[model samples]
Target: MKAKELMDKEFVYLNCDDNVVEVSKVMEEIRRFTCPVVNDNKQLVGWITSFDITKGLREGNEKIKEIMSSYEEITTIHEDAPARLAVVLTANNKFVTVPVINDDNQVIGMIRSCDIVELLSELYDIKVYKLYEAMQHQLKGVTWEELMSASALVSKKTTGVKISPEDYEANIMNATFGEAIWATGGLEKFFAGLISVGEMVIARKVGKARR
Candidate 1:
Protein backbone atom coordinates (compact mmCIF):
# COMPACT_ATOMS: atom_id res chain seq x y z
CA MET A 1 0.00 0.00 0.00
CA LYS A 2 1.12 3.52 -0.72
CA ALA A 3 0.73 6.62 1.41
CA LYS A 4 -1.89 8.04 -0.95
CA GLU A 5 -3.96 4.86 -0.70
CA LEU A 6 -4.24 5.19 3.08
CA MET A 7 -4.19 8.97 3.40
CA ASP A 8 -7.30 11.07 3.98
CA LYS A 9 -8.05 13.21 0.96
CA GLU A 10 -10.39 15.31 3.06
CA PHE A 11 -8.13 17.41 5.27
CA VAL A 12 -7.47 20.98 6.25
CA TYR A 13 -4.50 23.01 5.09
CA LEU A 14 -3.89 26.70 5.66
CA ASN A 15 -2.04 29.43 3.82
CA CYS A 16 0.88 31.21 5.47
CA ASP A 17 -1.20 34.35 5.84
CA ASP A 18 -4.06 32.57 7.66
CA ASN A 19 -4.76 33.55 11.27
CA VAL A 20 -5.48 31.56 14.43
CA VAL A 21 -9.21 32.33 14.47
CA GLU A 22 -9.82 30.92 11.00
CA VAL A 23 -7.42 28.05 11.52
CA SER A 24 -9.25 27.05 14.71
CA LYS A 25 -12.57 26.87 12.88
CA VAL A 26 -11.13 24.73 10.10
CA MET A 27 -9.43 22.45 12.59
CA GLU A 28 -12.62 22.05 14.59
CA GLU A 29 -14.61 21.22 11.45
CA ILE A 30 -12.08 18.59 10.42
CA ARG A 31 -11.68 17.34 14.02
CA ARG A 32 -7.93 17.40 13.51
CA PHE A 33 -5.25 18.40 16.00
CA THR A 34 -2.88 19.69 13.35
CA CYS A 35 -2.70 20.91 9.76
CA PRO A 36 -0.07 21.89 7.24
CA VAL A 37 0.72 25.41 6.10
CA VAL A 38 1.46 26.32 2.48
CA ASN A 39 2.67 29.29 0.48
CA ASP A 40 1.02 30.90 -2.57
CA ASN A 41 2.70 28.35 -4.81
CA LYS A 42 0.91 25.56 -2.84
CA GLN A 43 4.26 24.34 -1.58
CA LEU A 44 4.40 23.30 2.05
CA VAL A 45 6.01 25.98 4.18
CA GLY A 46 5.36 24.68 7.70
CA TRP A 47 2.63 23.22 9.87
CA ILE A 48 0.58 24.22 12.90
CA THR A 49 -1.29 22.50 15.70
CA SER A 50 -3.61 23.41 18.53
CA PHE A 51 -0.56 24.03 20.70
CA ASP A 52 0.71 26.61 18.24
CA ILE A 53 -2.65 28.36 18.26
CA THR A 54 -2.66 28.50 22.06
CA LYS A 55 0.81 29.98 22.14
CA GLY A 56 -0.08 32.39 19.35
CA LEU A 57 -3.11 33.62 21.31
CA ARG A 58 -0.83 34.60 24.20
CA GLU A 59 1.04 36.77 21.73
CA GLY A 60 -2.23 37.94 20.16
CA ASN A 61 -3.71 36.81 16.83
CA GLU A 62 -0.76 36.23 14.54
CA LYS A 63 -0.18 35.00 11.00
CA ILE A 64 0.15 31.24 10.68
CA LYS A 65 3.67 31.66 9.35
CA GLU A 66 4.62 33.38 12.59
CA ILE A 67 3.12 30.63 14.80
CA MET A 68 3.68 27.55 12.66
CA SER A 69 6.39 25.01 13.31
CA SER A 70 9.22 25.36 10.82
CA TYR A 71 9.14 23.18 7.69
CA GLU A 72 12.19 21.24 8.83
CA GLU A 73 10.48 20.33 12.12
CA ILE A 74 7.53 18.87 10.21
CA THR A 75 7.95 15.71 8.20
CA THR A 76 6.14 14.76 5.00
CA ILE A 77 5.84 11.58 2.96
CA HIS A 78 5.44 11.24 -0.76
CA GLU A 79 2.10 9.86 -1.94
CA ASP A 80 3.85 7.04 -3.74
CA ALA A 81 5.91 6.01 -0.70
CA PRO A 82 5.20 2.92 1.40
CA ALA A 83 2.16 3.12 3.68
CA ARG A 84 4.19 1.89 6.65
CA LEU A 85 6.31 5.02 6.33
CA ALA A 86 3.38 7.02 7.74
CA VAL A 87 3.13 4.73 10.75
CA VAL A 88 6.87 4.82 11.32
CA LEU A 89 6.99 8.59 10.98
CA THR A 90 4.04 9.11 13.32
CA ALA A 91 5.37 6.63 15.88
CA ASN A 92 8.81 8.21 15.91
CA ASN A 93 7.71 11.83 15.87
CA LYS A 94 4.66 11.31 18.12
CA PHE A 95 2.56 12.77 15.32
CA VAL A 96 -1.20 12.33 15.21
CA THR A 97 -1.13 13.05 11.46
CA VAL A 98 1.39 13.40 8.64
CA PRO A 99 1.04 15.29 5.43
CA VAL A 100 1.13 13.41 2.11
CA ILE A 101 2.53 15.31 -0.83
CA ASN A 102 2.99 14.78 -4.55
CA ASP A 103 6.17 15.39 -6.53
CA ASP A 104 5.41 19.09 -6.68
CA ASN A 105 5.44 19.18 -2.84
CA GLN A 106 1.74 20.09 -2.90
CA VAL A 107 -0.20 18.57 -0.03
CA ILE A 108 -2.58 15.91 -1.31
CA GLY A 109 -3.86 14.22 1.82
CA MET A 110 -3.29 13.57 5.51
CA ILE A 111 -2.21 10.24 6.98
CA ARG A 112 -3.81 9.65 10.38
CA SER A 113 -2.34 7.38 13.02
CA CYS A 114 -5.79 6.07 13.92
CA ASP A 115 -6.41 4.87 10.35
CA ILE A 116 -3.14 2.98 10.38
CA VAL A 117 -4.10 1.33 13.65
CA GLU A 118 -7.42 0.15 12.24
CA LEU A 119 -5.78 -1.28 9.12
CA LEU A 120 -3.13 -3.02 11.20
CA SER A 121 -5.69 -4.49 13.57
CA GLU A 122 -7.68 -5.89 10.68
CA LEU A 123 -4.62 -7.31 9.01
CA TYR A 124 -2.88 -8.92 11.99
CA ASP A 125 -5.36 -10.84 14.16
CA ILE A 126 -6.71 -14.17 12.92
CA LYS A 127 -8.46 -15.97 15.79
CA VAL A 128 -11.68 -16.61 13.92
CA TYR A 129 -12.63 -19.57 16.12
CA LYS A 130 -12.33 -17.43 19.21
CA LEU A 131 -14.34 -14.66 17.63
CA TYR A 132 -17.05 -17.12 16.59
CA GLU A 133 -17.20 -18.69 20.04
CA ALA A 134 -17.38 -15.30 21.67
CA MET A 135 -20.17 -14.26 19.34
CA GLN A 136 -22.13 -17.43 20.09
CA HIS A 137 -21.66 -16.98 23.85
CA GLN A 138 -22.38 -13.26 23.99
CA LEU A 139 -24.89 -12.59 21.25
CA LYS A 140 -27.47 -15.22 22.16
CA GLY A 141 -30.36 -12.81 22.62
CA VAL A 142 -29.49 -10.21 20.00
CA THR A 143 -32.69 -8.60 18.71
CA TRP A 144 -34.28 -9.14 15.34
CA GLU A 145 -34.24 -5.39 14.66
CA GLU A 146 -30.48 -5.33 15.05
CA LEU A 147 -30.13 -8.27 12.70
CA MET A 148 -32.40 -6.59 10.19
CA SER A 149 -30.28 -3.48 10.37
CA ALA A 150 -27.20 -5.52 9.64
CA SER A 151 -28.93 -7.14 6.69
CA ALA A 152 -29.80 -3.69 5.43
CA LEU A 153 -26.18 -2.61 5.75
CA VAL A 154 -24.99 -5.61 3.76
CA SER A 155 -27.61 -5.06 1.13
CA LYS A 156 -26.85 -1.40 0.79
CA LYS A 157 -23.15 -1.94 0.75
CA THR A 158 -23.41 -4.92 -1.63
CA THR A 159 -20.31 -6.33 0.01
CA GLY A 160 -21.11 -9.17 2.42
CA VAL A 161 -21.91 -12.86 1.85
CA LYS A 162 -24.47 -13.33 -0.87
CA ILE A 163 -25.45 -16.71 0.53
CA SER A 164 -28.39 -17.13 2.85
CA PRO A 165 -27.84 -16.15 6.49
CA GLU A 166 -27.96 -19.81 7.56
CA ASP A 167 -25.05 -20.79 5.28
CA TYR A 168 -23.09 -17.73 6.31
CA GLU A 169 -23.32 -18.78 9.98
CA ALA A 170 -22.42 -22.41 9.35
CA ASN A 171 -19.68 -22.20 6.75
CA ILE A 172 -17.92 -18.90 7.34
CA MET A 173 -17.80 -19.00 11.13
CA ASN A 174 -14.13 -19.94 11.21
CA ALA A 175 -13.03 -17.90 8.24
CA THR A 176 -9.94 -15.77 8.80
CA PHE A 177 -10.18 -12.00 8.52
CA GLY A 178 -8.64 -11.97 5.07
CA GLU A 179 -10.76 -14.92 4.03
CA ALA A 180 -13.85 -13.21 5.35
CA ILE A 181 -12.95 -10.03 3.54
CA TRP A 182 -12.44 -11.99 0.37
CA ALA A 183 -15.70 -13.88 0.86
CA THR A 184 -17.56 -10.72 1.57
CA GLY A 185 -15.88 -7.89 -0.36
CA GLY A 186 -14.39 -5.23 1.91
CA LEU A 187 -13.48 -4.48 5.53
CA GLU A 188 -16.92 -3.12 6.44
CA LYS A 189 -18.55 -6.32 5.24
CA PHE A 190 -17.26 -8.40 8.16
CA PHE A 191 -19.42 -6.73 10.82
CA ALA A 192 -22.56 -7.03 8.76
CA GLY A 193 -21.75 -10.66 8.00
CA LEU A 194 -21.40 -11.38 11.72
CA ILE A 195 -24.75 -9.82 12.51
CA SER A 196 -26.58 -11.57 9.72
CA VAL A 197 -25.17 -14.97 10.64
CA GLY A 198 -25.92 -14.52 14.31
CA GLU A 199 -29.46 -13.51 13.47
CA MET A 200 -30.07 -16.66 11.43
CA VAL A 201 -28.80 -18.94 14.20
CA ILE A 202 -30.89 -17.31 16.90
CA ALA A 203 -34.00 -17.27 14.77
CA ARG A 204 -33.63 -21.02 14.15
CA LYS A 205 -33.23 -21.71 17.89
CA VAL A 206 -36.28 -19.60 18.74
CA GLY A 207 -38.40 -21.39 16.13
CA LYS A 208 -37.36 -24.83 17.41
CA ALA A 209 -38.13 -23.89 21.02
CA ARG A 210 -41.61 -22.67 20.05
CA ARG A 211 -42.30 -26.08 18.39
Candidate 2:
Protein backbone atom coordinates (compact mmCIF):
# COMPACT_ATOMS: atom_id res chain seq x y z
CA MET A 1 0.00 0.00 0.00
CA LYS A 2 1.13 3.55 -0.74
CA ALA A 3 0.29 6.89 0.83
CA LYS A 4 -1.78 7.79 -2.22
CA GLU A 5 -4.01 4.74 -1.76
CA LEU A 6 -4.78 5.59 1.86
CA MET A 7 -5.04 9.39 1.55
CA ASP A 8 -8.40 11.13 1.52
CA LYS A 9 -8.46 13.26 -1.60
CA GLU A 10 -11.47 15.43 -0.67
CA PHE A 11 -10.19 16.86 2.56
CA VAL A 12 -11.27 20.12 4.12
CA TYR A 13 -8.87 23.05 3.61
CA LEU A 14 -8.61 26.72 4.49
CA ASN A 15 -6.98 29.87 3.16
CA CYS A 16 -4.47 31.83 5.23
CA ASP A 17 -6.73 34.88 5.27
CA ASP A 18 -9.69 32.90 6.56
CA ASN A 19 -10.64 34.16 10.00
CA VAL A 20 -11.16 32.07 13.10
CA VAL A 21 -14.93 32.48 12.84
CA GLU A 22 -14.93 31.30 9.24
CA VAL A 23 -12.66 28.42 10.08
CA SER A 24 -14.94 27.36 12.88
CA LYS A 25 -17.87 27.43 10.52
CA VAL A 26 -16.02 25.27 8.04
CA MET A 27 -15.13 22.77 10.73
CA GLU A 28 -18.74 22.54 11.80
CA GLU A 29 -19.96 22.17 8.23
CA ILE A 30 -17.44 19.52 7.38
CA ARG A 31 -17.76 17.72 10.71
CA ARG A 32 -13.98 17.60 10.92
CA PHE A 33 -11.74 18.93 13.63
CA THR A 34 -8.98 20.19 11.34
CA CYS A 35 -8.41 21.69 7.92
CA PRO A 36 -5.25 22.15 5.90
CA VAL A 37 -4.36 25.75 5.14
CA VAL A 38 -3.05 26.67 1.74
CA ASN A 39 -1.70 29.81 0.00
CA ASP A 40 -2.95 31.39 -3.22
CA ASN A 41 -0.62 29.18 -5.24
CA LYS A 42 -2.28 26.14 -3.56
CA GLN A 43 0.86 25.41 -1.60
CA LEU A 44 0.52 23.91 1.84
CA VAL A 45 0.94 26.62 4.47
CA GLY A 46 -0.45 25.53 7.83
CA TRP A 47 -3.24 23.64 9.53
CA ILE A 48 -6.17 25.13 11.44
CA THR A 49 -7.98 22.83 13.83
CA SER A 50 -10.89 23.22 16.21
CA PHE A 51 -8.41 23.76 19.02
CA ASP A 52 -6.87 26.68 17.17
CA ILE A 53 -10.25 28.24 16.44
CA THR A 54 -11.37 27.97 20.05
CA LYS A 55 -8.10 29.35 21.35
CA GLY A 56 -8.25 32.22 18.92
CA LEU A 57 -11.85 33.01 19.85
CA ARG A 58 -10.99 33.05 23.52
CA GLU A 59 -8.02 35.30 22.95
CA GLY A 60 -9.93 37.47 20.46
CA ASN A 61 -8.69 38.77 17.04
CA GLU A 62 -5.73 36.40 16.72
CA LYS A 63 -4.96 35.74 13.07
CA ILE A 64 -5.27 32.22 11.64
CA LYS A 65 -1.57 32.25 10.84
CA GLU A 66 -0.87 32.91 14.49
CA ILE A 67 -2.59 29.73 15.65
CA MET A 68 -2.21 27.32 12.77
CA SER A 69 0.43 24.58 12.83
CA SER A 70 2.87 25.72 10.17
CA TYR A 71 3.14 23.41 7.18
CA GLU A 72 6.93 23.63 7.30
CA GLU A 73 6.93 21.78 10.63
CA ILE A 74 4.21 19.28 9.73
CA THR A 75 5.33 15.71 8.96
CA THR A 76 4.49 15.09 5.33
CA ILE A 77 4.90 11.91 3.25
CA HIS A 78 5.09 11.62 -0.49
CA GLU A 79 2.42 9.82 -2.53
CA ASP A 80 4.68 6.86 -3.34
CA ALA A 81 5.91 6.30 0.20
CA PRO A 82 5.22 2.88 1.72
CA ALA A 83 2.07 2.62 3.83
CA ARG A 84 4.03 1.13 6.70
CA LEU A 85 6.04 4.35 6.90
CA ALA A 86 2.80 6.30 7.17
CA VAL A 87 1.72 4.14 10.11
CA VAL A 88 5.04 4.67 11.84
CA LEU A 89 4.86 8.40 11.27
CA THR A 90 1.33 8.53 12.67
CA ALA A 91 2.40 6.57 15.74
CA ASN A 92 5.28 8.95 16.39
CA ASN A 93 3.51 12.21 15.60
CA LYS A 94 0.28 11.50 17.53
CA PHE A 95 -1.58 13.13 14.68
CA VAL A 96 -4.87 11.69 13.45
CA THR A 97 -4.31 13.00 9.92
CA VAL A 98 -0.99 13.54 8.14
CA PRO A 99 -0.65 15.58 5.00
CA VAL A 100 0.53 13.95 1.76
CA ILE A 101 2.30 16.12 -0.74
CA ASN A 102 3.38 15.80 -4.36
CA ASP A 103 6.89 16.42 -5.71
CA ASP A 104 6.04 20.11 -5.96
CA ASN A 105 5.25 20.26 -2.22
CA GLN A 106 1.59 20.81 -3.05
CA VAL A 107 -0.79 19.17 -0.63
CA ILE A 108 -2.67 16.46 -2.47
CA GLY A 109 -4.45 14.55 0.27
CA MET A 110 -4.37 13.30 3.85
CA ILE A 111 -3.63 9.93 5.45
CA ARG A 112 -5.93 9.52 8.44
CA SER A 113 -5.48 7.26 11.43
CA CYS A 114 -8.54 5.26 10.40
CA ASP A 115 -7.01 4.76 6.97
CA ILE A 116 -3.84 3.35 8.49
CA VAL A 117 -5.78 1.03 10.75
CA GLU A 118 -7.84 -0.26 7.83
CA LEU A 119 -4.69 -0.92 5.84
CA LEU A 120 -3.16 -2.72 8.77
CA SER A 121 -6.23 -4.93 8.97
CA GLU A 122 -5.98 -5.82 5.28
CA LEU A 123 -2.24 -6.37 5.29
CA TYR A 124 -2.17 -8.41 8.48
CA ASP A 125 -5.52 -10.19 8.04
CA ILE A 126 -6.25 -9.43 11.65
CA LYS A 127 -9.50 -7.58 11.21
CA VAL A 128 -9.92 -4.76 13.73
CA TYR A 129 -7.56 -6.29 16.24
CA LYS A 130 -4.82 -3.72 15.67
CA LEU A 131 -7.33 -0.90 16.04
CA TYR A 132 -8.44 -2.42 19.32
CA GLU A 133 -4.87 -2.53 20.61
CA ALA A 134 -4.10 1.03 19.56
CA MET A 135 -7.32 2.44 20.99
CA GLN A 136 -7.63 0.42 24.20
CA HIS A 137 -5.15 2.61 26.05
CA GLN A 138 -7.03 5.75 25.08
CA LEU A 139 -10.59 4.72 25.97
CA LYS A 140 -10.85 6.80 29.11
CA GLY A 141 -13.67 9.32 28.82
CA VAL A 142 -14.36 8.09 25.31
CA THR A 143 -17.85 8.57 23.96
CA TRP A 144 -20.41 5.79 23.55
CA GLU A 145 -20.34 6.20 19.80
CA GLU A 146 -16.62 5.53 19.70
CA LEU A 147 -16.99 2.46 21.87
CA MET A 148 -19.76 1.14 19.67
CA SER A 149 -17.62 1.77 16.62
CA ALA A 150 -14.90 -0.40 18.10
CA SER A 151 -17.40 -3.10 18.74
CA ALA A 152 -18.68 -2.90 15.20
CA LEU A 153 -15.19 -3.23 13.82
CA VAL A 154 -14.51 -6.26 15.93
CA SER A 155 -17.76 -7.90 14.95
CA LYS A 156 -16.96 -7.31 11.32
CA LYS A 157 -13.54 -8.89 11.50
CA THR A 158 -14.23 -11.93 13.59
CA THR A 159 -16.34 -14.99 12.83
CA GLY A 160 -18.65 -16.82 15.26
CA VAL A 161 -18.39 -14.04 17.79
CA LYS A 162 -21.16 -11.52 17.82
CA ILE A 163 -20.51 -8.31 19.77
CA SER A 164 -23.81 -8.05 21.52
CA PRO A 165 -25.19 -4.92 23.09
CA GLU A 166 -24.57 -6.42 26.50
CA ASP A 167 -20.91 -6.92 25.61
CA TYR A 168 -20.60 -3.32 24.51
CA GLU A 169 -22.15 -2.14 27.75
CA ALA A 170 -19.79 -4.34 29.72
CA ASN A 171 -16.78 -2.99 27.84
CA ILE A 172 -17.93 0.56 28.47
CA MET A 173 -18.33 -0.24 32.14
CA ASN A 174 -14.81 -1.63 32.28
CA ALA A 175 -13.41 1.35 30.38
CA THR A 176 -14.43 3.86 33.01
CA PHE A 177 -11.60 5.70 34.73
CA GLY A 178 -12.22 3.61 37.80
CA GLU A 179 -11.71 0.30 36.02
CA ALA A 180 -9.83 1.11 32.80
CA ILE A 181 -6.32 0.85 34.18
CA TRP A 182 -6.81 -2.59 35.67
CA ALA A 183 -8.60 -3.82 32.58
CA THR A 184 -5.83 -2.47 30.38
CA GLY A 185 -3.28 -4.21 32.58
CA GLY A 186 -5.04 -7.51 32.02
CA LEU A 187 -5.01 -6.79 28.28
CA GLU A 188 -1.27 -6.18 28.37
CA LYS A 189 -0.72 -9.46 30.14
CA PHE A 190 -2.86 -11.21 27.58
CA PHE A 191 -0.85 -9.63 24.76
CA ALA A 192 2.42 -10.80 26.32
CA GLY A 193 1.13 -14.34 26.58
CA LEU A 194 -0.12 -14.28 23.00
CA ILE A 195 3.29 -13.13 21.76
CA SER A 196 5.00 -15.94 23.58
CA VAL A 197 2.55 -18.53 22.29
CA GLY A 198 2.45 -17.28 18.71
CA GLU A 199 -1.31 -16.82 18.96
CA MET A 200 -1.76 -13.59 17.03
CA VAL A 201 -5.42 -14.17 16.22
CA ILE A 202 -6.22 -14.85 19.84
CA ALA A 203 -4.39 -11.71 20.82
CA ARG A 204 -6.48 -9.72 18.37
CA LYS A 205 -9.64 -11.28 19.69
CA VAL A 206 -8.73 -10.62 23.32
CA GLY A 207 -7.66 -7.07 22.55
CA LYS A 208 -10.93 -6.44 20.75
CA ALA A 209 -12.93 -7.81 23.65
CA ARG A 210 -11.11 -5.68 26.16
CA ARG A 211 -11.29 -2.60 24.00
Candidate 3:
Protein backbone atom coordinates (compact mmCIF):
# COMPACT_ATOMS: atom_id res chain seq x y z
CA MET A 1 0.00 0.00 0.00
CA LYS A 2 1.05 3.57 -0.59
CA ALA A 3 1.74 5.93 2.31
CA LYS A 4 -1.41 7.91 1.60
CA GLU A 5 -3.53 4.77 1.72
CA LEU A 6 -2.08 3.76 5.07
CA MET A 7 -1.97 7.24 6.60
CA ASP A 8 -4.74 8.78 8.68
CA LYS A 9 -5.71 11.72 6.49
CA GLU A 10 -8.17 13.08 9.01
CA PHE A 11 -5.34 13.91 11.36
CA VAL A 12 -4.51 16.71 13.76
CA TYR A 13 -1.27 18.68 13.65
CA LEU A 14 0.54 21.48 15.46
CA ASN A 15 2.16 24.74 14.49
CA CYS A 16 5.67 25.55 15.66
CA ASP A 17 4.38 28.76 17.19
CA ASP A 18 1.66 26.93 19.15
CA ASN A 19 1.90 26.99 22.92
CA VAL A 20 1.91 24.02 25.25
CA VAL A 21 -1.70 24.81 26.17
CA GLU A 22 -2.61 24.77 22.50
CA VAL A 23 -0.77 21.46 22.06
CA SER A 24 -2.67 20.01 25.00
CA LYS A 25 -5.95 21.07 23.43
CA VAL A 26 -4.99 19.41 20.17
CA MET A 27 -4.10 16.22 21.99
CA GLU A 28 -7.40 16.25 23.84
CA GLU A 29 -9.36 16.78 20.66
CA ILE A 30 -7.58 14.01 18.79
CA ARG A 31 -7.19 11.59 21.71
CA ARG A 32 -3.60 11.22 20.60
CA PHE A 33 -0.50 12.38 22.40
CA THR A 34 1.60 12.74 19.29
CA CYS A 35 1.25 15.09 16.32
CA PRO A 36 3.24 16.43 13.43
CA VAL A 37 4.55 19.98 13.66
CA VAL A 38 4.30 22.36 10.75
CA ASN A 39 5.68 25.77 9.79
CA ASP A 40 3.87 28.88 8.55
CA ASN A 41 3.64 27.29 5.10
CA LYS A 42 2.15 24.25 6.82
CA GLN A 43 5.19 22.31 5.76
CA LEU A 44 6.46 19.42 7.80
CA VAL A 45 8.84 20.77 10.41
CA GLY A 46 9.09 18.37 13.31
CA TRP A 47 7.00 16.27 15.64
CA ILE A 48 5.69 16.69 19.16
CA THR A 49 4.48 14.38 21.88
CA SER A 50 2.83 14.67 25.27
CA PHE A 51 6.25 14.37 26.79
CA ASP A 52 7.37 17.42 24.88
CA ILE A 53 4.39 19.37 26.07
CA THR A 54 4.92 18.50 29.72
CA LYS A 55 8.63 19.05 29.53
CA GLY A 56 8.13 22.39 27.86
CA LEU A 57 5.53 23.46 30.40
CA ARG A 58 7.71 22.38 33.30
CA GLU A 59 10.75 24.13 31.89
CA GLY A 60 8.72 27.28 31.21
CA ASN A 61 9.23 26.73 27.51
CA GLU A 62 5.61 27.16 26.51
CA LYS A 63 6.18 27.66 22.81
CA ILE A 64 6.13 24.58 20.61
CA LYS A 65 9.03 25.90 18.57
CA GLU A 66 11.21 25.75 21.66
CA ILE A 67 10.28 22.16 22.50
CA MET A 68 9.11 20.30 19.41
CA SER A 69 11.70 18.10 17.76
CA SER A 70 13.47 20.12 15.10
CA TYR A 71 13.00 19.29 11.41
CA GLU A 72 16.50 17.83 11.27
CA GLU A 73 15.74 15.58 14.22
CA ILE A 74 12.54 14.21 12.68
CA THR A 75 11.53 12.17 9.68
CA THR A 76 8.81 12.28 7.05
CA ILE A 77 7.42 9.91 4.44
CA HIS A 78 6.01 11.01 1.13
CA GLU A 79 2.34 10.38 0.44
CA ASP A 80 3.11 8.66 -2.83
CA ALA A 81 5.88 6.51 -1.40
CA PRO A 82 5.48 2.90 -0.37
CA ALA A 83 3.82 2.34 3.00
CA ARG A 84 6.76 0.24 4.13
CA LEU A 85 8.80 3.41 4.41
CA ALA A 86 6.51 4.63 7.11
CA VAL A 87 6.74 1.24 8.79
CA VAL A 88 10.52 1.52 8.94
CA LEU A 89 10.39 5.03 10.35
CA THR A 90 7.87 3.97 13.00
CA ALA A 91 9.74 0.80 13.88
CA ASN A 92 12.99 2.73 14.12
CA ASN A 93 11.25 5.07 16.52
CA LYS A 94 10.37 2.04 18.63
CA PHE A 95 7.05 1.74 16.86
CA VAL A 96 5.72 5.12 17.82
CA THR A 97 4.33 7.32 15.01
CA VAL A 98 5.32 8.91 11.73
CA PRO A 99 4.05 11.78 9.64
CA VAL A 100 3.11 11.69 5.98
CA ILE A 101 3.82 14.61 3.68
CA ASN A 102 2.95 15.59 0.12
CA ASP A 103 5.33 16.73 -2.62
CA ASP A 104 5.26 20.27 -1.36
CA ASN A 105 6.53 19.05 2.02
CA GLN A 106 3.13 19.79 3.52
CA VAL A 107 2.08 17.46 6.30
CA ILE A 108 -0.89 15.40 5.22
CA GLY A 109 -1.39 12.57 7.67
CA MET A 110 -0.01 10.39 10.46
CA ILE A 111 0.50 6.66 10.84
CA ARG A 112 0.97 4.81 14.07
CA SER A 113 2.52 1.37 14.49
CA CYS A 114 -0.86 0.01 15.51
CA ASP A 115 -2.14 1.04 12.13
CA ILE A 116 0.36 -1.21 10.41
CA VAL A 117 -0.52 -4.13 12.66
CA GLU A 118 -4.18 -3.69 11.83
CA LEU A 119 -3.29 -3.60 8.18
CA LEU A 120 -1.44 -6.87 8.60
CA SER A 121 -4.38 -8.39 10.43
CA GLU A 122 -6.67 -7.40 7.56
CA LEU A 123 -4.32 -8.54 4.82
CA TYR A 124 -3.49 -11.87 6.44
CA ASP A 125 -7.01 -12.69 7.61
CA ILE A 126 -5.71 -13.64 11.05
CA LYS A 127 -8.40 -15.07 13.33
CA VAL A 128 -9.03 -17.12 16.47
CA TYR A 129 -6.02 -19.25 15.62
CA LYS A 130 -3.73 -16.63 17.11
CA LEU A 131 -5.56 -16.92 20.42
CA TYR A 132 -4.67 -20.59 20.57
CA GLU A 133 -1.07 -19.75 19.77
CA ALA A 134 -0.95 -17.24 22.61
CA MET A 135 -2.46 -19.73 25.03
CA GLN A 136 0.05 -22.31 23.91
CA HIS A 137 2.85 -19.94 24.71
CA GLN A 138 1.56 -19.80 28.28
CA LEU A 139 1.72 -16.05 28.24
CA LYS A 140 1.76 -14.93 31.90
CA GLY A 141 1.48 -11.52 33.49
CA VAL A 142 -0.42 -10.83 30.32
CA THR A 143 -4.06 -9.89 30.28
CA TRP A 144 -6.48 -11.88 28.13
CA GLU A 145 -7.59 -8.68 26.47
CA GLU A 146 -4.15 -7.98 25.09
CA LEU A 147 -3.66 -11.56 24.01
CA MET A 148 -6.96 -11.91 22.17
CA SER A 149 -6.55 -8.54 20.47
CA ALA A 150 -3.03 -9.26 19.28
CA SER A 151 -4.07 -12.67 18.04
CA ALA A 152 -7.63 -12.18 16.79
CA LEU A 153 -7.89 -10.53 13.41
CA VAL A 154 -10.61 -10.08 10.83
CA SER A 155 -12.94 -13.05 10.68
CA LYS A 156 -16.51 -13.66 9.58
CA LYS A 157 -17.14 -16.58 11.88
CA THR A 158 -17.42 -16.32 15.65
CA THR A 159 -17.87 -20.15 15.61
CA GLY A 160 -20.74 -20.04 18.12
CA VAL A 161 -18.37 -19.79 21.02
CA LYS A 162 -19.73 -17.99 24.03
CA ILE A 163 -17.67 -15.62 26.12
CA SER A 164 -18.71 -15.08 29.71
CA PRO A 165 -18.76 -11.75 31.55
CA GLU A 166 -15.22 -12.25 32.81
CA ASP A 167 -14.01 -13.05 29.33
CA TYR A 168 -15.83 -10.04 27.95
CA GLU A 169 -14.06 -7.73 30.37
CA ALA A 170 -10.72 -9.36 29.73
CA ASN A 171 -10.91 -9.61 25.98
CA ILE A 172 -13.81 -7.66 24.50
CA MET A 173 -12.63 -4.30 25.81
CA ASN A 174 -9.18 -4.44 24.26
CA ALA A 175 -10.94 -5.72 21.21
CA THR A 176 -12.02 -2.09 21.14
CA PHE A 177 -8.62 -0.70 21.98
CA GLY A 178 -5.89 0.51 19.58
CA GLU A 179 -8.82 1.78 17.56
CA ALA A 180 -10.62 -1.56 17.37
CA ILE A 181 -7.63 -3.32 15.87
CA TRP A 182 -9.69 -6.23 14.67
CA ALA A 183 -11.67 -4.04 12.31
CA THR A 184 -9.96 -1.60 9.91
CA GLY A 185 -10.77 2.02 8.98
CA GLY A 186 -10.51 3.07 12.64
CA LEU A 187 -13.01 4.27 15.33
CA GLU A 188 -16.03 5.88 13.65
CA LYS A 189 -17.62 2.74 12.13
CA PHE A 190 -16.33 0.24 14.67
CA PHE A 191 -19.23 0.72 17.08
CA ALA A 192 -21.66 -1.35 15.01
CA GLY A 193 -19.01 -4.01 14.56
CA LEU A 194 -18.33 -4.01 18.29
CA ILE A 195 -22.02 -4.48 19.07
CA SER A 196 -22.23 -7.28 16.54
CA VAL A 197 -19.35 -9.12 18.14
CA GLY A 198 -20.83 -8.72 21.59
CA GLU A 199 -24.14 -10.09 20.36
CA MET A 200 -22.38 -13.03 18.76
CA VAL A 201 -20.65 -13.90 22.00
CA ILE A 202 -23.92 -13.75 23.92
CA ALA A 203 -25.68 -15.83 21.31
CA ARG A 204 -23.05 -18.50 21.56
CA LYS A 205 -23.65 -18.83 25.29
CA VAL A 206 -27.43 -18.99 24.73
CA GLY A 207 -26.97 -21.75 22.17
CA LYS A 208 -24.69 -23.69 24.52
CA ALA A 209 -27.16 -23.55 27.41
CA ARG A 210 -29.92 -24.81 25.13
CA ARG A 211 -27.85 -27.80 24.02
If scored against the real structure, what TM-score would every candidate get?
0.60, 0.57, 0.57
What lDDT tens digits, residue by residue, belong to model 2 across residues 29-104? 8778877888887688898778888989998854688789887677888989987788899998778888888888
Displacement of the residue 122 alpha carbon in candidate 2, Å: 3.4
Better of 1 and 2 by TM-score: 1
Worst 10 residues of 2 by lDDT: 193-202
Q: Global CA lDDT of candidate 2, please?
A: 0.68
Q: Could you give me the TM-score of model 3 versus the true structure?
A: 0.57
- Tens-digit per-residue lDDT, 80-128, candidate 3: 9999888777777785778888989999888878889888667444443
Higher-ranked by TM-score: 1 or 3: 1
Highest-TM-score candidate: 1
Determine which window of 10 residues in candidate 3 has minimal summed lDDT: 150-159
Residue 174 Cα positional deviation in candidate 1, in Å, after optimal superposition: 7.5
Name the lDDT value of residue 173 in candidate 2: 49
